[model samples]
Target: MRRLVGVLVAVGLALGVVSAGPASAAIDSSGSAVILPPDQDPFYVPPADYGSRPNGTVLRSREITALAYVMPIPVHAYQVLYKSVDGHGAPVAEAATVLVPYTSWTGPGTRPLVSYQIADDSLSTRCQPSYTLRVGIGSPTGVGSYEVSMSYQALLRGYAIVYADYEGPHSQFAAGPQAAHGVLDGMRAVLHHAPAGLDPNTKITLWGYSGGGLATTWAAEQQGSYAPELNVVGAAAGGVPAELGAMLRHNNGNLGAGLALLGVIGLARAYPESGVYGILNDRGRALFATNEDACTLDVAVLHPFDRIENYTTIADPIDSPQARFLIDTNNPGQATPRMPYYNYEALQDEFVPAALADGLLKDYCADGGTVKKVRIPFSGHITGEVQGGPGALQFLADRVAGKPVTSDC
Candidate 1:
């Protein structure tokens, strides 16, 4: 890997450039961010036997300082690359940042785990939690910063936190099964990471919001079938994009139109058989390619209020049979989670319709899952986090205390 990076650097020097255009900027790291060599870049070159390894098998681990943006925190941080599966059921390697709080558990049987998936809405390695959690490193969308701040809150409560990339090596951003596999395998990696001193049987809570909420919900729904042994106590997700079709339809012509476009790009990357690219016009292709390395802010700034229909050659790209099939396959709450759930949605959300989230809670209830649903009024997408976080934390606290959850469903 060093040799490969050296050659690339040498070539870049020959060409009088340090980084290679937008691809280099895609990860959105600072000038001081530790640059990995090409061969060693986990995002670029995964292990040859990636899918062959057992799920959750830790391929590599490196200790690093946990940071809240640029400031270091008193936590034991380990960056781990673990075995996971992709949308195609192929083996893939995923990365996550595990943080063991310096404080001890004063009120619990054991320090519970929080698989805190962040809203890393990007198809770039640089946006991965493991990368952005380092001091001086930042994601273009600032989502990483927000995630670290939230993780710090969990650290204060004596919970070990694992921030999984979830997007996998291919940066399959919105693929449900792929994200679930990455998150589950990430938990496996952290639990077995001896140095973290966590019990294998420790109870866990899956917590996330927005894009992370989508991944968290999927992980919760798949945990019974995929990682049945995990002692998950509850899942707390807010601002969930439960129905992709509804989200896309709502995002169209709204300020969040860029996210809708990016969702299509992500879906295409995850399920190429859907043939999204094949249906695209030249303008559509260019727009899609331009967003290949974009983060949240970039996407919104570049294509705010843009409609998905404007980019495709077909009358309605989202309703195409291939797209519909993939969307249905990825929608969450198909299976019942073995544990209780705390689902909250902003009634005024412009990105994901509140009705869709309500439907997800209803679907989970229908599947015999215990669900406590909350609707935060007067809150939109971004502000919903502030309004809903305290309630979610309290719910998670109750679970950590081994108290029985009172179901709203």
Candidate 2:
């Protein structure tokens, strides 16, 4: 715990909250200065005519040193800024980091691609995997940096991985369609890049938990329609908030309320037409302004057990017409995935109710979609990710091997 606190203090110092110094500066393995955060980086800016380019077209490319706890990993890493569509189908530039192992693949068929989504439950571009996975001072505090360790497991297995900033340029945290487009198009950009050396016919699988799970499931549901040219074999989503409204209600006025509020901000960013900001009172507006660029740790640590009604003008803002429309539009399970699906949930999840996953799987099965379900006993939202990860990985392995999946539904 002492070491953890020390790391947090160091992060605070780097963020300029505790002390002032050369912020956002860290030495890479090559002894060069690391790239600036996305907010301050020119690479994140897309060309004005990027909208005229095809979806998934690479706008910018840069080679980056991948890191694991400040040490450089022996792998080839590249970040691509690609064109994608937002929730309303407007052109937007999204970023993704593609990692290829130094070791060659000895597995069946060509090398497999795993689009691993990191749970970037933050409102800052600095929290995206494209920035966080690089060797830099900000990496320790970047939300995706910790989860990139799990992507290394797939890299060890000779699977090329792409970590997309599925939240898009604005960091729309819970907006589903925008995330889906970003994930699918990131895969497209990776395949289109010649230097990546990935086969165009690479079998793809998706894995993520919590907010990542939300993005993975959204991509899985929309892949058939949005990017049917790509070969997506299977997907594994755990600790999923399958229904946005249900999750908001479950977490309101509880320990997860701060995170829930972040989701509201994200939704408002994705759909300004919903008028979420207009409904906010002075306190709500102030809190939103403060946390608009906050990382997951900032929200989780600073605003636990918060009540939305404390800041909003309405007693039940979630039940308002705009909120209802946002919820209905973003919720998954309206369509079934073309490939096999694996879902895991915590029976006692506090942030997202298990019944939502249960109902989603049931609906998928009824729609003739291949589905696998696992329920972790005595686990809450966080522990469910740890306990369910191995099973999810195994399920992906079977799909990659072309093994038949048995649907529990």
Candidate 3:
């Protein structure tokens, strides 16, 4: 296994794919001069027998300082590589960052676990929270760094938080099953880690907004079947893109077209049988190659108000049979969540229509799931996170406190 990792590292360096930084470079609260990204980092590579390990089994772990943007957060932090499954149920190693606050848990039960999913709406591994939350490695200007503030808030409440790279190793953004498995397995890994001093039976609440919301909700729905042993009590998801097809249709040629395209690229990665590359025209191929490792802001700035037809050979690639199948397979709401769910949506959201989330909650409710729905009026996609966070946090807090919740279904 060590030999395999060394060979991989050598190949990466030879190809100029990995960071060629000094090994002795000091890693501190203030950003380091050079830090290896996940693709090049040795810790991310699992052993040859990783697939033989049980799901959520920790493959490797290292202590690191957690950071909210550039400032070092005073907490016990560790990045863990664990075994998980992809969208296809194949074993895959995933990464997650676990944070335990200095202050002890004074809450009713064992310190609650908040599996905080950051909205990594990018095609790049650099956007994963496991990397971005590390000191001196994360981009201070990136969205991942900004979202770390929410994790900081949870840490302040003495809640142990696990920020999973729920998008998986490939950064398979918007791939529902993969994301769900990653989040659940990450929670499993953290709960089992001895150094964190967490009870194995700790109550857990899932929380996220936007892309993160999609992952949280998926985990909520899949936990009943995929990770039934998890002690998840509730989930709070804000600004969810519940239906991917609807999102792509809503954003086509609009300001969010680039973001939608990124989703298409991600889906292609997750389900290669979708034949996205085969249908792409020259322009589409070029765009795919260029944005293959791009972050959310990069796509948002580069391809806003762009049309899908401009890149594809077919007039409506999104409506094609392959795309439709992928969409139906990935979309949430088909299954009922075993635990209570809180969903908040921006009524004026442009990227994801409010009606899609409404329909999703309606279905979940009709299927006998407990759901609380919040509609934020006069707020769009970006502002809805700020407006909806407090209520979501309170919902999580109530669940952690063992407060009885009435279904707003």
Report, for every candidate in turn, its global Cα lDDT versus the true structure. 0.79, 0.84, 0.84
Q: How accurate is candidate 3 locally (lDDT)?
A: 0.84
lDDT of 2 at 39: 71
Best-first order by TM-score: 2, 3, 1
Predicted structure 2, TM vs. truth:
0.93
Q: Candidate 2 at 173: error in angstroms? A: 0.5
What are the candidates' C-alpha RMSDs?
A: 7.2, 3.3, 7.8
Q: Summarize candidate 3's per-residue lDDT along 1-409 as a digit string, tens digits.
A: 4565466556645543333432232355644445567887899999999998899999999988776655778889988899999989899999988889888888786988999999998787776787777743335225777677765677778999999989888889899999999999999999998898899899999999999999999999999999999999999999889888889989998989878888998999899988888899999999888778777766665566789889999998889987997899899986888989999989888787888888898899889999998999999988888888989999988888888999988
TM-score of each prediction: 0.90, 0.93, 0.92
lDDT at residue 297 of model 1 (Cα atoms): 53
Per-residue accuracy of model 1 over 1-409 as CA lDDT, tens digit each:
4565466556534532222334342222244556452224654455777667799998888887766755777888888888888877888877888889777777657779999989977767666677667633333335777766765677788899999989986677788999999999999999999888899899899999999999999999899899999999999999899889888888888878878887888888899888788888888899878767656555654566788878888888778886797798788867877889998889888787888888888787787889998998998987888788888888987898888888788
Q: Weakest 10 consecutive residues, lDDT, candidate 3?
A: 17-26
Candidate 2, 1-409: lDDT as tens digits: 4565567666765663332322264566567775777777899899999999989999989888888766887888888999999999899988988989888889889999999999987787877888777753446354566577766778878899999999988999988998899999999999888888899888999999999998999999999999999999999999889888888888887878878988898898889999888889999999889877777766654566678788888999889887998898889886899899999999988888889888888889899999998999999987888788889888998899999888776
Error of 2 at 291 (Å): 1.4
